[model samples]
Target chain A: MTVTMEDVAREAGVSRALVSIVFRDVEGASTATRERVREVADRLGYRPDQRARQLGRRRTRLVGVTYAVHLPFHGELVEALYAAAAPTGWDVMLSPVTARRDETTAVESLLDHRCEAVVLLGPSLPSRALDLLFARVPTVVVARSVPRRTVQVVRTDDAAGARAATEHLRSLGHRRIALVDGGRAPGAAERRRGYRAAMRAGGLDDVALVPGGPTEHDGEAAGEALLATSPRPTAVLAFNDDCAMGLLNTVRGAGVRVPSDLSVVGYDDTAVAGLRAVSLTTVGQDPDALAHLAVTRAIALAEGDAASAEQVVPPHLVVRSTTAPPP
Target chain B: MTVTMEDVAREAGVSRALVSIVFRDVEGASTATRERVREVADRLGYRPDQRARQLGRRRTRLVGVTYAVHLPFHGELVEALYAAAAPTGWDVMLSPVTARRDETTAVESLLDHRCEAVVLLGPSLPSRALDLLFARVPTVVVARSVPRRTVQVVRTDDAAGARAATEHLRSLGHRRIALVDGGRAPGAAERRRGYRAAMRAGGLDDVALVPGGPTEHDGEAAGEALLATSPRPTAVLAFNDDCAMGLLNTVRGAGVRVPSDLSVVGYDDTAVAGLRAVSLTTVGQDPDALAHLAVTRAIALAEGDAASAEQVVPPHLVVRSTTAPPP
Candidate 1:
């Protein structure tokens, strides 16, 4: 009555070898063949044995990554992760979930793939979801703050980065400054906190905080709103470069001169920040270091290292032509 | 004796069930167990019979994609491809290969994965590569021209787009113009041919062609070269938006004003072209439409549809604030 590879293969109309290949996740079998083999095995009430397999091998050498944010910078992070992991003979597989898919579903999907360890980038998953994932697999969270003792966390200092931006503007003698904030974004709350703290620290507590989203469109809307204020702020610190670029465009379209009439600063020095046309002043996070640390920590946890609660990375500023003294 | 799942399970010291899960590529097994199973199987010289397994199942709904270009726009294209294909019950698996990997090797890698069909993005592979691939599996190419009679091709109309850009500037009373050409890029030859033909057709063969590359750095270099020219051309047409953004930055740094002193036009109306700061006058190609077409054609080929040699999509131009009459 026990299910056999032959039984499943026969039901799926494939040879036992083909079924084995599909199960092994080896290259050479077409995607169609793999899908068919998995379906047939599932139908035949088949299950794979794990404890024996582990005893036979030293390591799985597979890392799973789940990313909720698809910003262009994430692509760079993914590339960096590949570079960091590849030399160590580890392969990274990505499973991306949109807003519609909850964190549990995403984590479960990675678990389904038997990922040795999982990394969640800017995850919006609840704390319970993190606890569940920690119980099932070695889990690492990037840019998410979780109080659970079981999970490992890696994050850039968003609050500090925000404060740096605000201070940079304040040092330029801009009294009436504004922050185009990333409203309800993953790291928005921490960034807002940083901005508030910095404003107070710099004795510019009256600085405006404008609500915005993560996209360039939101930046434009925020820029338009800021322009409507009775006394326009001389300097603006945007949530990120995308928003800054949007704000730049909207302000320029309204015939405002940059660095003379208005000085703009952005965050996350993406490739666009360095573009000749944009040349945005912004905050920089070492994406390469962040990726390397996440993967190395994930591997350590997979190898049975005790989990740590947090890994915090410092932030720095990259000044270009976007900010100037108020005229 | 032919290698068996029992042998793999036994070697791995995992239960047959664990081996099955690992081999099936299912979710439940831990990463450690899956790696072990695969390692043991590899050591035992196991090769799964993919064709046999596929015959058992009606079809495997997986598509394989190999991206040769790493530009951000290419990432967007890949994303679009995934979005277009996912709705049809198909999932995409990526095969990471370097530019050094020849077309034959690339195709072989896909074959090893048993991809139902393959999509090559901006492949550097020659026509013979397409011939070799068509022999084993159905294939579609994006942004590459292949002379093979059997392989399907999808590309944007680079020539027409270039013409529109040239005409736009000419109509705005710009007599002295220059082109920052993308030398030896995949579509560069077509774009260059388009630019030359358009200039000749408009009775303006005196325009300069400055050699360039695909990167923003290249654009900066081109901008420097153009600036050094005597009575510098009133307008410059860059290879793409990235290059244009770079040139714009470089020229602006040199104290030249866009539109008033020097008009700049770019190709590939990617998301960058629309940013408020970089309101580039650019040639537009519908990436969504192109992605939809590429996926639809790829699926058709996988379903055994008769293969055609090539498919071309038209390109248009979007006039933003970057272009104006010469001062």
Candidate 2:
């Protein structure tokens, strides 16, 4: 049988209301009474029910995170979010989005847990769904931007990063540079726009844009497609590190040497990108900076602050063994 | 602006008790009354406070998970856990242990959030801490064993897995084999015992065990040490896949040809192990099975069932490009 607060109050010879006030830690009861009630509760193994306390109080001080378990980049962001939330005296409540669990389930679980706000990492939810969410609770979308200004966003400048990658190849005397399209992935349009702008600026009209995705298998398929194209691109910029790695492996396995035959650059310099075997050149997003800003903005908004504009962080290229002057 | 049950009751022209019964789906209200109350509540945007309902109920149906965000293996297990818990109608709450957040803090926060049970993934907590935690709330420790038989455990047979890895190397006609120790990590001791037994069984007592750890950096250091020994071993069994990848990279960087000059086998066939560039031969633990058993045990324990015995899952070795017969 579970011991209740009423049992603790009876044992302590105090009113149930006084015990409740002490448990809530609000301005109430004498110090001596508080200590006595705590002692009684401990002796009786009575715990103040977390849910009951929420009904009696106004704050939970929990910041919920909705991130994909499969994505290593999201894992890094979650760790950074914990560090960022530590200083604000708010706890992080994680509700992971897995293959079986959808975004709505993840967000609803957090809301059900009484989290003051939520942080969606690389969310794939539609704008209208996000709008419905923001209407109910404060939300911050990280690593992706939504159309509405009403939702807070902390994201990397995809266009600039894409431009930098393309220009890096162009400067290496590679005239035929290609970009593996991310399809409808968040910020894919911006990267495509950036690549086109860079190619136009370099007077390189033959832009090779092949359909790809954010995974390794997608990159492998894209690699086959690239290899089959007439006047194949000497260089390819992948949507992300996984795609880059897949493409690198496929082309290498097919007797095309990386850097010497084809140069590949990946985005989101994840941990795998730094593996000695996979030494991928890619764009690095600052997880700590983005996480810190997102947490700050989320806490402020939860405290009834006005909706703020989107905050964009700059991404830089990390050169490694995968990139060299095109053959 | 929060909507209260009082507002719903007033709008529906019913008592607060009637509204509560309707939301709780209890047997108090008539069919018409329940429908009218729900309609009024929806119009008022009155979500039943999750916390308040806990005070009025006996179960939460929440299984809290304590895992490290930095570990890919943990990420995989978390995904599996979500899949496992779905059939049981329970939701998982993740509380990741980061560099700054200790395991105790992680567990306590979940406790404060009203989680009914906890699943510790590759937990590094000492026996005493675990004992306290298990005593308070039902816990299932996955991928690791604890001291007490009273506590529920769902783990891989580490010794069996290690023995298989050693025998795999031995069958390749490699007399000189080394074991990269996991050094105090869970299952490290069992692996050591298994390797020692295998060496004795093979009558090839050239046991070369180098101190290592769970991370890739530790493997690099172990690789350096292994390379320094007189009459270097031709085959090495690494602690885990990350360790194996690191050792492979480090030795390759030092100009050692893999499989011809040295053969490597790793434990825990993580996704990285299957990469075309790093096709590591490794022992594979089935995450789905372990997760299923763990959720079953945890939910059962939380439901007032007697503590069941530890559940052991078998592990199999996956042969890839990294291992071959001795040169």
Candidate 3:
């Protein structure tokens, strides 16, 4: 029950092509024709579609971002991305991936908004799926690595981060260090490999790699698994901050004192880990630097520059109250 | 030098109106004209704008939600909203408010996307600004109360929630209960009033109101102030979970055990509050029910149903490891 462009064209007695030009604000129509079309369109109650009007014009200068709503780290990165994009004359459009919204749906919304480029924050999608996105739009994947050499990437060296966490616990006189692995979670394999390599380098070949996920509940379950293991580890390096927090909490609740009984180190020094109550020793990813690089690459690609290279940001270990010399 | 629709029309030897029809997939253009326009558009690489094509004649069926990216509770509510919108044949579009993006910009982006209605999650904007938006679009404000009778609001009874938290502390046999007030934050005044009312009803009219903000650092500072008081309250209610966690950590570090020596309670039972280590007893705002109500009202308003009414959902207290009978 809505008025179409055809209706306006017929009423105005002009070609539909002329009306399209007037609405698009392009150079095809004369000023008189433009005014006439506008009058007729207004008379017909044509609700102007911004996207239609802006099409074939200059750039929208919009950068789309897809992030998981539940991840606190993603929240921090999104804040950093906004700061990064502003001075560069670009606006950020967020399409959050919630429980009911998938990455494809979220990404498509951004494209629908006419965003020139997209920055995907640690997406857990398959390589084939990413190839499709890269083919369609200029994409920069953050916090996760992609296999395709042609895809641009801005991410942390997950293996190095896990190594730093493992080495920190080892330096604190912790001998039996166990890794709470992230299983198939993004960067999990790299983290697991990093932990194993660090332990082997420390001359502790026997590794205790317990399966964990990206949630606090997973961390709690992993903590129980650790408690049940015959030779309890003196220290544990968790997949991420949430898991580390859960593990730390469960062990404490079971009468095991942190730093005295178990030295726990978490990845991604999220805001929660720094709380006085948690004070989790964790690895920190540089959100600002990573975001800056991502936007830089995205803007370059959007402006018709080639960007098939990857930029790796280093992670730093933050020693907090949760980690100390193993008893 | 992006290919415009004018170029496609000229290349296809068709009127611009006919080209627009072909691209929009709407009636009025013949099969031959549509095929010719499609062939020309593909050859010219005229990137079709989705939003432009989905205009008029029918609904975009999009419900836009504005939420603060930094809030964990907001994250939960957004997930709930997505689930609520999916069943009603409506898609959810997210515009996250970060440090760089304000509420105005967020809402405007939604409008630009041609969303039928907008749902703002606890906006701290002035009433006058909201009136401007209300005049332009169908808006529903969630988790925040507006004084305007005509504004549609779906929110928790914050005063009742605060009162429930205070009453729970009093029932646990704590006499000197201090209220850590969220100074100038959204719903702070109502919460303060509720706390005061509960205190006055119990004949504990000499209220210990501590100035606090919504962060963990604020709670730590409030905890220091509480420790310095001559007769420190046996129980304290914080502005939020983050503040309560900070206060708990600081007090415990100062050799004051929780619940045994002092009791602590918080508002907004975020994910972190439920952790066994930070088992914060806090008030729960039902995101599922609130999201359902907000979407239902938004769809109604979008469908021409007038809604100047406010719906207040009740909040329940979640008793966790943080609260116990005061010694």
Candidate 4:
């Protein structure tokens, strides 16, 4: 049997109530009695149970976060969220969604912990579920669009970022540009729409697009397809930095020079994009501003402030060696 | 003031005990009364307090996990650990170590949730602190080595993996090889020792060593230094896949051909290594086996099993398209 507070009390020759007070580290027990009770508890190999003590508290002061493990950008945002929560006296609890674990399971774990508010990072959940969640608790959706006014939103302007990327390549005299789309991802549609609109505005009759996803392998596949085209595009815009890097490797392997032969642009300037060896030109989102807005909104809603806010941060183009005038 | 269980019970004309039974989903409350209480609670915006409910349960069946957000391999291992723990009916709580947050703050959050056992993935804590943690609760350390026998350990044989990588390059007719080290990471020392031993075994009088760390930028720096040497090495063994990829990009940019001019080898066959565009030849550690051993040992210890286990899985070389005969 496990040792309990009563067992420590009996060994230390003190009342059970005194042992409880000492173990909880709260006032009402004398210093000598506290020391004696702790010694006896230590001798009995008894650790204080945090769950029991939490029952006596009125507030948990916890904010839950659900993030995908594979997204490096999401990891950065989580780090920033910690800093954002420090000044507000709130602790952040993370529930990670991996390949094996679904978003539902992650969100359920957060609810089980009784977090006052929850922030879902790049959530793929359906709109109805998000609306229900917003009604149930103070919910903040990041990197996804939600129509409900009850939920708080924090996201990058993907369409504007994609338009900027296309216009930059067009200004460099690249008429044949292709967009390697991220199929079914949260921000894919907006990016695709932006690319199409920019191409139309540039008076390009023929628009090129290839199927891709959020991985390097997908980028490689798209690159191979681009190489096999009748007239290879002068420039390519990938869904994200990972895809862009993959395309770069594929193109370089085939003896095709970047920017000189085919200028490349990517989204989400991750750590890999900034490396001296890579130096990928990409669209960069301000994760600090996104995290700050999400945290502030969640805190306000959790603290019974009824106003829900929607925040949209613009993405900027980070030009490097990857993009140049096509030969 | 926030709505409480007592307020909900009073408004619904039901006892607080009955309302709790309904909230807990226990069979004590009648169906009609349960629906009425839930309806009244919803109208009053009263959510069930999980902390109060958790106090009545004897076991939490929660295993806390601590991992670094920057390490992609750790992310894969975490996914595998989740699969391994599914059969045991235990939930996982994640605490991430990031640039802004320290391990202490992360661990404290897990302790606050009252996790039954903790599985620290590549912990950077000192041995004395690990021993103290083991005494306080059932603990398992993955990737990092601890001197305390009370704590369970699961790690790859890093020295053997490094030796295999070196030998693979040696077998490809490359004599002059340089080592790009990880620099103070968990398995850096062992890998460095293994590379040195393999070089000496191959009877190479002059061993080339360069200063490189865990990231791609470090690899780029090492590559720059290697290029400046009078006689550049015929082969290079990077500390990890990230470093190798960086070196590959650097060498390519300098008009140096891989495998034909300088054969390259990397450690830790990460997802990026397996991509067709990269196709990095590296050492592969079985993450599934490592995660399984750690989770099983953690569960056994948490259930009061006294036998502490130390598990070391061997690493094997994955011969991809990277290594070939040197010019």
lDDT for each residue of candidate 1 in B3-86, tens digit (9 for 90 to 100)? 566788888898877876776677989988888788888898654432333323445455777764346566666767767887
Tell me how far the alpha carbon of residue B249 in candidate 2 is from the true structure, in angstroms, after superposition. Answer: 3.2
TM-score of chain A of 3: 0.83
For model 1 chain B, the run of ten residues with the poorest summed lDDT: B49-58
Q: Least lDDT summed over 10 consecutive residues: which range in candidate 3 chain A? A: A48-57
Question: How do the residues A66-132 of candidate 2 rate in per-residue lDDT, one tens digit apiece?
Answer: 9988888998899899999988878788888888789998998888777899999989999888888
Give all candidates' CA lDDT scores: 0.78, 0.87, 0.85, 0.85
Q: How do the predictions measure up, each by TM-score?
A: 0.75, 0.88, 0.81, 0.85
Candidate 3 has a TM-score of 0.81
Which has the higher TM-score value, candidate number 2 or candidate number 3?
Answer: 2
Each prediction's DockQ against the real complex: 0.12, 0.46, 0.37, 0.48
Q: What docking tier does model 4 reach?
A: acceptable
Give the better candidate number (2 or 3) by lDDT. 2
Ranking by DockQ: 4, 2, 3, 1
Better of 1 and 4 by DockQ: 4
Q: Pick the candidate with the highest TM-score.
A: 2
What TM-score does model 4 achieve against the real structure? 0.85
Supply the TM-score for candidate 1.
0.75
